[model samples]
Target: MRIPFIFIFCLLFSAGKAQEFAISNYDVLWNSQSKNSSESMPVGGGDIGLNVWVEDGDLLFYISRSGLFDENNTLLKVGRVRLRFPQNKLKEGFKQRLNLADGACHISGAQSGLQSDVRIWVDVHKAVIHIDIDHSKATNAQLFFEHWRFEDRATKKKENNQNSWKWAPQGDVKTYADEVGFENGSLYFYHQNKKQTVFDVVVKQQGLESIKDSLFNPLDGRIFGGFLYAKGFVNAGIEEGNYINTPFKAYELKTAKPSKRQQVLIALQTGQHLSPEKLKSETQKLALNSASSAKKDFKNNQRWWASFWNKSYIQIPKTADTTAYQVARNYNLYRYMLACNAYGDYPTKFNGGLFTFDPVFTDSTATFTPDFRNWGGGTHTAQNQRLVYWPMLKAGDADLMKPQFDFYQSILGNAEWRSKFYWGHNGASFTEQIENFGLPNPAEYGWKRPESYDKGMEYNAWLEYEWDTVLEFCQMILDARDYQNFDVKPYLPLIKSSLRFFDEHYQYLAKKRGSKALTADGKLVIYPGSAAETYKMTYNASSTVAALKTVLQNFLQLPNELLNADEKAQWQGMLTRIPEISYRDIDGKTTISPATVWERINNVETPQLYPVFPWKIFGLQKPGLDTAINTYKFDPDALRFRDSKGWKQDNIWAARLGLTDEAVKYTFAKLKNSERRFPAFWGPGFDWTPDHNWGGSGMIGLQEMLLQDVDDKILLFPAWPKDIDVRFKLHAPQQTVVEAEVKNGKANIINVWPESRRKDIIIK
Candidate 1:
């Protein structure tokens, strides 16, 4: 049966209208003065990012680019640019707005009755940033490059606290930077890493010097450089650092004549093993090319952002309650931040994600360089890091997931070598807090460990026995495959190896215990396991158990051609040996247990809800939904630890369990206006300002509230509040999308891809 033409047209028209409405409704507006870098607005394209702010009556923006790791493994900023007009024209009447529809920042203000308007944006097709200024009257302007780390300095011990293996501090750490100078009326700077990197030092410190050659190194010979060009400006004298005596050099450019309009361009270039001359040449070419095609590139940049916004959106109706508006506004704001680093070489960092500002603003005692953050550089905590990327599937940002997937795959050899070298195992063993070179972070591993400590375990109590979070990432890849039908053949080895490590490692532990280490029920005895840093010395930890079971089951469901018969049989046999999820009775109500047995509690995490989220073993359409609900309601730890902060899963689990009131309460808390200038720039809570994981988890919770899927069945408004009206377009499995609107207790399905998938829709 063929569909009628008018009906099809109506469906398309409604979908377009919803997208247009979402784009027009949510844009950040600021009319107050920005006191510091923390109050800055963000703008970016490709792999470049800028935090544009007006500080002390001057326009200042910090330049940051993805994959610009220095020799010490710190992610460094490119430089800072300060633009000043005659008589400080940006002091009052300042209004800066982030136009989300075009990915640009517009700043306008009047000083002494002189109107000035500035537009800042990054070229989507080129490695350049353009700042266009137009004034009502001709005026002289000056642009300067402000750099703090101008000389080679020894890293102080206080700054080394965040690095891996802080106890075994090496001799004075030397920092390096690009040589900056003025040439042909332009300021040029560049930094190139040495042939050797911190990876070699870390490997030797961990007693792996003999096998260092076998490990992967991701930082050798990396180079980054850029040139700043401003039309009609001549080179001015440089100024040494005066603030805090942090030795810095300033390159000044003064306008040759008073002009109504002036433009500045900063072109950047980065890669591995590029010569200094080549970098300079390329940067110059980029600046010239961008200057010649500015108009065309601006239009293309706008189009790119428009397409990004069109991919997916969520909008709530106007309400007198400010919280409701903030929930919808912050959702879009956080998503925009994610899009800034969409093409990064590394996955967005959980701490600050390229938008980090001065450290003194965050902690009074912690006065350090702009590169400093809570967690060490090049170290990824799997638990916190996983939250940063989980929501991309629902947001229809599948392409943005590649950097993370590639990161794990890049380090596969090192992970496998470590496992085999230590325990003669055939699978890779990824640690909880992992380094880019594929091993436990040295500082977190603890240098002064006792002889009885396990070689593969982290010395920190919070990270010990926390090896299951990688499965969540594996699950992400599997889910992405289902949502987009993308090729997973490259990732199959990674998924299988991760599961294989758990099976082999547990069996190895059982053999060490005794000849009959297997339980009477013939299940693997997972001892000395920690349930998400909370339960110490536990057996059959529920989080790890659920991850193992869920991943293995999902793996088997894939096409047989993707997995050989022998591999299939091995996984099937291993699944049965895994322990059943444990449960307990709390006040006469059955609830999920953190683990079967544990010596003591350590952290504040609620691991019992693992079965409810990340693994859909007992939620919504799954069996034992009532039992999971009882656990959520009755569990003491779950109640005590519930909050919206760094890496918290309470809001997500509540929505997954179909608890409308609980979900709304937590979602509102998660999406509330952050103290920062940008509404979505949340937290230094357990992490850093503009916490990526905090925002990422909040995004997941909101998405779950609107739509959830179990196999082929899609449930709409599962945990959404009836009083709150919403329109959203979210992705589901089998290349399907669910666009729907809910108002006045009525749900309307706008469209579903492939048409045939609509048969499985279930309104909850």
Candidate 2:
């Protein structure tokens, strides 16, 4: 592999000239000093720069970045969650402060009956924290978070935390013999397989023996008890979490480590142990065994990440904003965080994200949620969430992409189950809503207005058309993982159900265009459900058209080796009647969603791009390529829309349309806009923290615009604009990797790495 140019690391940033966090707004944002103490520095939320909120009573906190080192310290920062037993509610004999640091950031508020089963930890070099929280908590446990920046008294300036000394906190969580540990630099947190808890607590601090007591808040019942300047967060469950187990996961790629190879051995040894306290004798032996290589490993860790940043990165060449670099880095870093926090089994698709940080409501800025939120999955949200995975797919992050595929698989079943109910047969019918569990949730999660998705509207049944889009992604996961022992056949039932629904549902809409003719003889048009999402709408939506086309095409592409002849022909037949997309001229503007006229659109972009984005039905393929392009261009909002003068949906659709300039504009728009956050992670104008949806899309938009390959042809600057030049490389399916640089509306090839065995660039 060629060495890269930029540096990528787990950064700790602070607004007060200390290391802490990032947010969209770059201006002078302020947060409350924690009631716990005055010594804490405010940490900006990692990516979404979300507004902070301390809820119930999770006032205790200290925010510290994993893998960060203080400039002068040889040891890593090890922040602790030192909570003293409440004096008033305590026994007189002995009030002890529980203070051990090496456990993963877990939520175990000492509930007597509840086992501290959940443990959330950042995977090696990954920012994604794997969560193992209990779904049974009736009273949400309180969380304590703190962020501190070291100011060197001698330099008389805030100390940069990039070089912090790394060490495990001496907390009881680390005392478990089965507690996981890095050999030298790996980031995976493992517990003894036979351990009692699902997670281990990880303690981190900047390694200062003691900071001023002022840093902590004097014990108070309020969320802002800490005097230390820190951020806090609270999660309101998903839109449908009550139906399924509360699923939680974090996203991030491991930081290039100091001693990855060596850590493998150390980790293996750690896996062998059960508890540190019980095996103190063995612990000392292992520490001594690993001491000699510490220095060498640390240096290598920095260099590895530095090499990664050198390749495939976005640098703001020239921006008027003073915090341009911060914003630029924030966007990229958050993408890194997304990758780092991403999981292997489930990408946590719409189940929501891992490091969702915010500040205590009292403090205007910083915070982190110890527990995962309830269920929620949005139609408009899927693409943005999928964006984070685009780069990951090529970065050799196959495991990270699993959750995304699992989500699709789960939904396929959900669509099929709904279809079976609605169609009165073995097929798929999509409802407007779904949760982490693979089931339709109209019974709960109904819109307050209660229309389509919830069965009040006429066209809700057509929502299943969107499932075809999910099928295409399933194909991607199939290719990414080589499909090796993974049994996707089980999911084919859903695919069959979807095709069955579409083939039987579609009707000739060409005969009914507007007015009484729209209803024709008023036969109460049956079948083709609406594309869902809106209240009441028409049958056979452009979205359904795009999706039906996608589904038909996907079945045809499945290798003959993988499918039976009968199944293949059935899919081919469904491709024939693919519905026509409807468009109207609102002063010559062609838009794609359910309504063609192009209004303010309470919903975001048109579903027509289902073929363009998550679905790959129309590319430089068959013919609609130009039509698709025109439709995108004709709509004013296709690339840019002024929602109260603020831009939305532009960042995503631009990339889908291959409009690199538009994509970049939307990207920097979120960055440069005054109302936007300074750190530039991008959020809706309303809140400072990032909506993970948009944050994920930023990565996908940029990736799609830069490089695209269907089967054989790799298009350079396909939709890239003349103003911006991009340099990057991506890994394609079947082991082929593509790297290049584009400038002056042209691309220059850099490199391509092909896995020894892989196939199908663009299938015919």
TM per candidate comes to 0.94, 0.53
Index of the highest-TM-score prediction: 1
Expressed as tens digits, the lDDT of each residue in 388-454 for candidate 2 is 5555654445545655665555556544544444444455544343333333332222223333342
257, model 1: CA deviation in Å? 2.4
- What lDDT is reached at residue 433 by model 1? 78
RMSDs, each prediction? 3.2, 18.2
Error of 1 at 21 (Å): 1.8
lDDT of 1 by residue, 1-764 (tens): 13346433533555565643556567777787688787888888777889888876688898988878777777788888888887546766888888988888998887887788899998877789999999988988888898876877666766654444344455667667568888677878898988767787778756677888778887788889898888889998897664332456788898999999988899998888899888888898888788888889999998888778766788886662679778888888888888887777888888888788877777776677766777766788888888889999999777778778878888888888877877888788888878887888877787778898777667887788778888998998888887756578889989988888887888888888788757898888888798988898899999989998989888988888898888889899989999999999999989999999998988888889988888888889888999999988989988888888777888999999999898888888988899878888888888887788989988999999999998779999999877778888888887777788887768989877657888999988
Model number with the top lDDT: 1
